[model samples]
Structure formats: C-alpha cells, structure tokens
Target: MTVFAAEQQFHDAEASLPSHQARLACRAGLAQTTAGVAPGYIQGNLAILPETYAAAFHRFCQLNPKPCPIIGMSDVGDPMIPSLGTDLDIRTDLPRYRVWRDGELVEEPTDITAHWRDDLVAFVIGCSFSFEEALLADDIPIRHIEQKVRVPMYRTNISCAAAGPFAGPMVVSMRPLKPKDAIRAVQITSRFPSVHGAPVHLGLPQSIGIADIDKPDYGDPVRIEPDEVPVFWACGVTPQAVIAAAKVPFAITHAPGLMLVTDLKNKHLAVL
Candidate 1:
C-alpha cells in the first residue's frame, strides 16, 4: 500500500486509542508508523543490545543527549519495562522492529519473539513524536502527519561523542515550516528537552551537510513550500546509525517512525 493508504488505514483502525491499547494493537501484528497514534501519551525509539555492550551504549546516550535522550530501559534479559507500561513487551510492543547483524539490517519483523536473547538490554529513547503533540496543540503544522508520511530524517555532518565502539554522525528529523512558525516551533519544543527540546539547525540544509533537501537518509520526504524553511531536530534514530558504524554483532531497533508507546503523559515530560 501507498504511504497515504497505510496511514489512513492506521488512522481508521487505531489512532485514537489509549497507550496500552495502542501497544496491544502493535502486539497483535498491526505494523505501521506510530507518528499520530496515542497522541497525548509519550512515544519512544527502541534500541536493544547485548549486555556486553549495554554499558558503553548507555554511556553513548549520556554523552550525546540531544540525539539519545533515554526515557526507559529494560532490565537485562527482561522484555517488560514496567516504567514505560506494565504490559509493554519489548519483543512485541512495537509495530515493527529492525534486526541488525554485524551492522547490516538482517530483517524487519512484526514480532521479535524469535530473536529475543537472554543477554539483551532494551533502551527506550525519547522521541520527537512526544514533542509533536505540543507543537500541534500550539497550532504548528506537522507536515509528515498532514501528508500521511513518516517524518523525513537525514544523517548530518555533525558528529556525535564517541563512547567505546559506539560512534557515528548525528541524525536529524525535519519539518518544513514558514519562518514565523519555525520560530514558534523553537520556542515550543524547547520546553521539552527530554524529547529533543528544539531545532538544532534551520533554513539551510547544506549547512548540515544535507546535499539534497528532497532526499533523506531515513524516513519519507515531504514537500517544502517556498515560504517554508526546513527545521532540523536531533532524532532518536542516531542509535541505528551508531550501530552500523560500530558494527556491533547484533542489535535491534524500532523501524524508523515505528515506536514504543508508553503510558506516560506527554505533558509530564515538559520542563515548563
């Protein structure tokens, strides 16, 4: 199905559910971007690794807070992260998962039960979707949601702080907005530091090493009107890039735009 068709189907079937029910739908095999689902609740990016690499990866997140603000973590070998949701199963709660082996994407699975390992550690990173709710509440237009597509994300020239076999260039999500709205977005998103906080770069994509605005490194592209400027925010997808660069033997991450929905309210994450 086309992006619009898939989004419409997801909207009609599950967009308005509460967090727990949204997860239940994912666990039931409904795979699609989690962008507009469970709007008021917090959503997160997933990264699972072996316990042998967990400490370094944890330090990587701490070193590079903007692109890896951790929201929740699972106990080693446990699929449940009760702080995120009592029933949130790391192996099955996300709509889709990307399994990586030696830095290469080996599979995109709807359920990861077959791949779950005893030494695995799951990390939940704060997602831009959590802050998008605030932007929408403030009347800011989110083009990806309006266009029924995943947000455009690109790898930038900016480098992340390296932490023991975990290092890569930063990745950012973009939203095109008119100059005035871009300013408002900065002010609005800055209040939620845990969810990326604010625009990391604006207007000139080339300044950030993005050669073509139409093509993105990850996620789908959206139109950029002449009156609008593309705003970039650090994305949670940085870990996937790091995994590729580090060439870790094994790893699992939520498919771009697909997330783990949590019971925590978005408002609860705001600094203001």
Candidate 2:
C-alpha cells in the first residue's frame, strides 16, 4: 500500500484517541521534526546495517537493552517490520533518513531505495519520545515542544559494552523537569521497557561526562529552568555512536527527530 493509503485504514480519533491523520501527516512529510507527533503513541529511532554485521549488531542491542531496545527488526533485504505494525515498510515510513558510509554521514534523503540493498537489516529502537505521552498525561511540560525544537542529545563519557564491530560510549537525551515531576516521570516511564525505561541519572550532567549541556552533540538544545534539574536517559543515538566507532562500511538512520510512526499504540508498550 502507499504509505498514506495504508495509514488511512487505521482508526484514529483525536478526542477519544490520538489523531492517526495528524500522526500520518507528520509521517507523510508534513512535519520536519517530531517533537510532538502522536502524543500518546510510541515513536522510534531507526538504524539499518548490512547483513555482514547484522548478527553482531543484534547481539549488541540484546546486550545493551537500555540504549538499544529493539522494537522492530526486519529480515535482511526486507523493508517490513511486522512486530511494529501490520504493514510497515522501513524505507518509506520515516519522514527523513541519514545515509552513512564508513561511519560518515554522506546524505540525508527522504527515501532510501537508491541505497537499499539485498543484505541490509533494519532496526527500530524505542525512543524516549515514546514516554512523552505518559509525561504529558501526568502534566510534565516538555520544553522543546513549547519552543518547537529537537530534544537535546549529547555524547557522554559512559562507555557501552563492545560486541564484535559495535562499540562506543552511550549517548543521552536530556529533559529538564521540576524535582517532583521528575520523580513522576521516572515512575511513568519505568513501565515501557521496549522504548527506553527509567532515568539513567538525574541532577548532574558532569557526573555522566557531559561537558557542555548548552551545546548538544545532536538535536537542538532546550532551555533549562533554575528550579528544574536535567534528567538524562540512555538514547538511541548510542547505536549511531557504535556504528561510527566501528567504522561500518555503510549504514542508515533516521534524521534525529523524524521517526517511523507505527500501528502499535503507546498503551501497548506500558508495563501496567
């Protein structure tokens, strides 16, 4: 089915449900960033690698569950991610893509058929954005959304476990929350292990080796409140870091804030 055609088949109600049409709009190239897409639906970070390294990469994700939780994975040469939806195709589902070669990002394309190969495995990792629903449900204000910017992501000194050709330090995405709301966020997010679960650390960025909070390694930086503490979570960027460190010949990832909208509801990912 055409991407838009397939989406219209789903039931999406804005008042009693999150608008699937609005969600489809973002996925159909209407929005440049997904700071706020399907408010109560799960979003993901994407990574695709050639078959030669897919086995080791899968193991790497299994070993490092926090940063690389695999929500959907496709067979080599397959664009479908059945676990995520009834008819999801990795190639055209996302609004944007980043093509990397030998660890260097060479192009940002809306469609990747020119780069698709017979030996590639696509991975859809859970995004912390998945938890924004819970956070909003409980009334935690998201600064980036209010400002309409990408969530700030940073490279940390924390190192990830090495697996064959995949190894690198963890990358984290930060959100500033009032002390009380931060605790609630921790409680709300803990239920979704498929997306990231729980805060890795809070209050101090330097302790985790983040030198410049104002300058993020990826995504745009958001403002921090003096009354709020910056909370950090293990991010999907960790895999990109691994790909860069390993210097893989070729790889593809979603452009930072653009994501694949799946048929799986955010409620389905909740532990309770």
Candidate 3:
C-alpha cells in the first residue's frame, strides 16, 4: 500500500475505536503519531519517574506551567490512573515509549510492562493535539498534519525554573502559519489553558535558541514557506528534556508525537 493509503487505514482504525481500545491497538504495534487519533479525546504526554523524584518534578511542572501543564497523575506505585481514563494502564497505552537511563535514551519500546516499578509515579501532561483540533475546526491549516508527519519540536535556550533534579531547556513545538492565521490561532488557543494555552514565540526561531528552522530537535520537520512564519508553543514534551538534563537514574516518556489516548474530551480541558 502507498503511504497515503496506509495513513488512511490508520486513521479509519483509530476513528472506529474508543480511547482504551485505540490504546490497546497501539500496544499491539500499530505505531503512528497520536495527532489525529481518537478525534475529540485529549491526548497526553507521559512521564513516569521514581517516587523519590516525583515531588520535585511536580514542583517543576508548577513552576513551568506553560510547558508542563499537568492533566492527570497516577498514585505512586500504581499503573492505572482512573481519572485520565477508565482501565488506563501506563505501561501499554501509548504507541511508543522512550526509556531513559541517566539522561540517555536506552530503549524505544512498544510496551513498558516489564519496566514497571512500585516506586514509580506516572504523570500525564496536556498535549498540543487538543488545540490543533480546535485550529482545524476553524479551518486553519496544520502543516504537519497536512503532510502526514509528526509536529516539529525543539529544545530552546529558554530555561525552566529548577526543582530538585527537574530542570532543563524549555522545549517548544512549531507550526508555520500565515500572519493573519497566527493571530487567529492565538485567539482560538487562548481558551485552552490546560493544554499550553497560546504561542510562546513566533516568527524568529533564533530568539528561542532554535538555531535551524529546518532541523528540529524532536519529531519530523515540515516546510516553512516564505509567506508563512513559524509559531512556537510550550510543549508537553518538555518533561523529557528535563529528564535528560537532570540525569535521573531512570525515567520513561512517550516517544515524541506518540501520546496516551485519554477518555477526557478536549473540550473538557478548555478554560473558556
């Protein structure tokens, strides 16, 4: 099958399944970015860390609210976070997971069930997928989605306030938009504070320490046309960067663009 045909099939399968079942499919190896999956459902970035570091990480998130908005968290030593979704299993929900050891990526796995530990705490952070859905509703184009690729993410020079071992460069996701559309996006996204709210930086990538517009630190890159400017937003993936910077003994995160499918609807996260 052509890539487009496979893409359509993936979308169709995702559309047919409820959130948990979609997650089950993901566990079964149907790897794809969670971007358009499950329609209105809230997709979340995952971070699982030892309980010893949980408090400091929580504080870190609180200090850097824009990039690390907490959507849901599992009790220490538990795999299930019932508030995020009924029967949610942190080890197997997302399509892919990144296992980090002392700030290095040690594995990209389909399931982390074997890695689960009693001292671990799971965190779910709000993702840009919520607002991207809002943008599409208003007929705004999402270049990465149109190109059938992951959104571009970068590690910027902007630093997060430190909390124990949970400090790092602020990571932002990029979306190229024409000037007028960008203005409208700010208006549309402002309503969703739980999901990173609005753009943090626009136009000049260099201002945020993004050295090259075409080369992103994470996820797939898309074109930035002459008529368009790149808009950057605080991203949930910031935690992974923080984990790397802190060099914690062990950590786990959703692979960039792969998110946990949640029962909570995107509309439920909107502040407006």
Candidate 4:
C-alpha cells in the first residue's frame, strides 16, 4: 500500500499526471511523489540507460520475461516515450528517480537534466499495481493500500536471464490474504499478461528463500494474520535489484511506488 497523501507534490499536473505533470514536476525538482496521482490508470517502473548499454539492457528485459516485462521504450536521445502516452517525456514524468554510477547509488534526483546524455534510453515496465487493481475489483481487500503503508518487498534467490552486464535475483512483493481470496486472485490475474499477470508464489515464503517474514528489503511490513498466509508476486523491484547489482557505469530508475502514470487505463490492459 502507498500513501498517496504522503507523496510530496511539486507542481500539480493541472490535476493530471505522467505526461503533463511529469514535465511540470521535473521542471520543479519534485523528484518523489508519494500518493497515487492518476487513479484508475496504469503506472510503470522506469529504467534509463546510455547508448553503450541500451542494446544490452533491451536484450536483458526481453530475455527475462517475468521480472523485466517491457511496456514502453524510447529511441536513443529521445526523451519522449511515445508508446506509453501522448507526448510522454521520460525525463520528467516520474516523481523520483535513482541515479547510479559504477553500480553504486550516487544520488536521488527528481530530474536528470544534469545527468542526461544524448546516448540515454528509457524503459517503462509492467507493474504489479495493475494486478492489485484486479484483486480490488473482485473485492479483495489490500491491507497496505487501505492502511496507507508501503507493501513489503523481498529479494529472492530466483535468477533472471542475464544479458551483458545485467543479472540478479528476482525480487517479490508480499500481500497478506485469506487462502480463499488468494486462490481467486490467481484465477483473476492470469488474464492480464502485459501487467505482470499473476501471483508467482502464495504460501510458506521460506520455500522461496525469504528467511524472515516481517523483514523486507524494500517497502514496509504489513500484518500477517493467522488465517492469512503471506502471498507473493513477481515485482517491478526485480529489475531494480538486478540493475543495482549489475553496477552499470550509469543508470536511472523510478523510486518504488513513484510510477510513471500513463494515459493508458488499467482496463485497457485487462484481458477480460
């Protein structure tokens, strides 16, 4: 769950986001926006690269279908990711972005103008939030979204297909749910392939190498009721974890939950 209220706003996107607001926020230096800005819209996980590594990264995403599912991309030196939304500018749509150098986190910036390069390319990936929308549509309660807390995310032992310098374990997001609801979610989410289709693992997290249930590598911890076993899904974090480990000379990604809100509606991606 993300606190839509907790996200700090720079300049309102005239009551819209992703296209117009991204440019506005990037211009204002509000790198991190917390709350869900575009209700009922599809938001994305972001990844940016220089020309030298764009080909390799592109191949990496293609090879690792589940963890790095590509949604939209840009040609080298093009800030406009036309595939996602009309006039969508990659450099300024997301509220926050992470700057990496030599595989190390160097800075967290709202805008990357100082770091932008002609060789740079950007990628937008499918997010689990789209699936969560499906679950909610079925009346399955999401604890974090309801309580305004960050969903728990864990680094797993699952390996991703390596392409060039990119290779790392898959990360997953957790949500607590009753067994019946979890089962139904599996059936409902299987239809949307473009938005991270369904839950990868559902019970006994240790089976996947997550030693501690309460501890998470990203996001915050949520309650685990006795009647509710922890349910896990392949997350957008998988790519970020891989990028951080790969340690490319320079790379950028959206801060967790600070998604690239697109004009695309969640219904547009729904298979039903």
TM-score per model over all chains:
0.91, 0.88, 0.90, 0.89
Which window of 10 residues has the lowest lDDT sum in candidate 4? 5-14
**What residue runs in model 3 are displaced by over 4 Å at the alpha carbon?**
1-17
How much is 111 displaced in model 2, in angstroms? 0.9
lDDT (CA) per prediction: 0.91, 0.83, 0.90, 0.81
Q: Which stretches of candidate 4 lie over 4 Å from their true place?
A: 1-34
Give the least accurate 10-residue stretch of model 2, judged by summed lDDT: 11-20
Screening candidate 3 with a backbone cut-off below 3 angstroms (N, C-alpha, C), the clashing residue pairs are none
**Per-residue lDDT for 15-92 in model 2, tens only?**
223433544454466647665666666678889999999899999999999899998889889987777764567877
Number of clashes recorded per candidate: 0, 0, 0, 10
For model 4, how does the per-residue alpha-carbon lDDT over 1-272 read when each residue is reduced to its tens digit?
25664353422334555545544555566655534665667788999988888898899888877777898888889899776786677776677788988889888787777777898999899987778887898999998888788889998877778899888888889999999998988888788777777878888788888999889988998988899978888888888888888888889998887778777788788777
Best by TM-score: 1
Model 1, 112-217: lDDT tens digits are 9999999999999999887888999999989998998888999999999999999989999999999999999999999999999888999999999999989998
> Can you rank all candidates by lDDT, best first?
1, 3, 2, 4
In model 2, how many backbone clashes occur? 0
- Please list all clashing residue pairs in model 4, or write none if there are none: 1-144, 1-145, 4-35, 7-34, 22-92, 22-93, 31-95, 31-96, 31-110, 103-247
Judged by lDDT, which candidate is best? 1
